[model samples]
Target: MSSGTSVPSPGCALTRGRLAGVISDDAGRPPLDAARLAAADPDLLPGLHVEVLDAAPSTNALVAERAHEGAAEGLVLVAEHQTAGRGRLDRTWETPPRSALTFSVLLRPTAPTHSWPWLPLLTGYAVAKALRAAGAEAEVKWPNDVLLGQRKVSGILLERVETASGPAAVVGIGINVGMTADELPVPEAVSLAVAGVEVDRTDLLVDVLASLWEAYTTWQEGGDLAGMRLAESYAAACATLGSEVRVDLPSGEVLTGTATGIDPSGRLLVAHDGGRTAVSAGDVVHVRPV
Candidate 1:
């Protein structure tokens, strides 16, 4: 996580209906037509201003910039293609033209800035809830991966920005909906289409935003809450629970353990040889079944 500098990036914020005028570069991409999509459901997005771009350096980057420029909370930035899409730990995110749902949401958290660590997990829970509502089998991996039957379907990256008013998060979400195996950069990557299911991109986005709003509202009430709810939902949908797995720590240490569940603070509770280590962060890999 980079320390958020207070400099606003260069870009003007678009008002609500102003986003509908943007056009995609590709003529063949039908639903990539921002005007048509927004027109179909103007009321779907509540209290949120939206901006559509044909292509961008990165939606997350642009949203962070917009936030610095005083874009209101709930402002969404979407692009048909992103040249510099990314994920957690600076992993490359593939956002080919007209193939993926590449977007970012601006959120000014009521929670403390330190609590921003859990934003990715909360966003992951929202994605899982959205997919389940769309009739796709889904679960949230610890930290920030959304899975469909043991295969990754979507990933999230939450970036923080320092605005004059306060600190805010630009939650970047890339969901693979219509991509085929050949189109996916990672051989292990799977899409909703590859899972033998088709999902409407607009509907999925609506559900995801709604779920995120709900989670945000819950967190605003302030208890030892949010993380626990996310953990429980993640655990229930996650198939890795009770399995032996390898956890890759950021420090280059790999530990083997049996997955127990997540703790209240959103750490992975691994029953390792050391006896119940709470893993705050790691790349989890389920081992081959014996």
Candidate 2:
């Protein structure tokens, strides 16, 4: 599922100016203190190595490369800005420097490859839970989009890479944090600050990572969503289920139906006039019934 989009030059004036401001604002922003994070939960992310980058083309790209080079699980990469951040369907995802939480984690799960589809779902549930814990009413859109009041505040991307040891999953997450109105990439995007949540970025990241780790461990224990109760939690926090929606399939066909449920494998189940269809991959949009 590798695709490319043309991005503005990385060294453009706008990028450099934004990076400069972000660097200057670091003095006042909350630092992602490794010691404090590890101490916050000794059981979570044990022996994890954290790297903070001032800028990168994409954290997922960097982490995927490292995973291939035998980078161990629990390696976390965070970047202040991503010039070529990617979202679902190879869409470009960009936010102003320091206005978002952009990071990737390398996970070498013991779960069977058949069950790997649940990774993004579990990650979405974890992110939604973390956001709610931070006082925002967050919910998940199908296939791992985190929304705060119908506006997307975060996104998750999972990539499978071949590591020296074996295959690994690189999970990339981006959360809008402090972007002002002028900085928002689109009208449907909102940030924590704009949503009226005053939170420390470091604290938010720690909470999210901890939640994700717990979810991952539980999945590994069972190798299935039902056994780990992940499906139940994900359903409870997902806003897409039980809604009239439109799905844009990869083959360029659009299906309009009511989102009935999510199957055990995490594919969306939609009921239309014809019958029921389980969609494994597509872009879903919630629609208002006329």
Could you say which candidate leads in TM-score? Answer: 2
Model 2: weakest 10-residue lDDT segment is 9-18
Q: Enumerate residue pairs that collide in model 1.
A: none
In candidate 1, what are the lDDT values of residues 1-290, reduced to their tens digit? Answer: 11111222222223222222444545354454343334433344456555656667678987888788888888877776777888877888875676778889999988765566667777888788888888888877767788887778898888878999988889999998888788878776889888887777766666677788777767766556555665677678666678787777666677778878877666777787788877765344333221
For all predicted structures, in order, the TM-scores are 0.83, 0.86
Model 2 gets an lDDT of 0.78
List the candidate 2 regions with Cα displacement exceeding 4 Å.
Answer: 1-22, 26-31, 223-228, 282-290
Q: What is the C-alpha lDDT of each candidate?
A: 0.71, 0.78
- Let me know the TM-score candidate 1 reaches against the reference structure: 0.83
Q: Name the 10 consecutive residues with the lowest summed lDDT in model 1.
A: 1-10
Indicate the residue-level lDDT of 141 in model 2. Answer: 88
lDDT of candidate 2 over 130-248, digit per residue (tens): 99999999999888989998899999989999877989999999999988878888998899999999888878887898899888888888654354478888888989899888887
Off by over 4 Å in 1: 1-28, 32-44, 225-227, 282-290
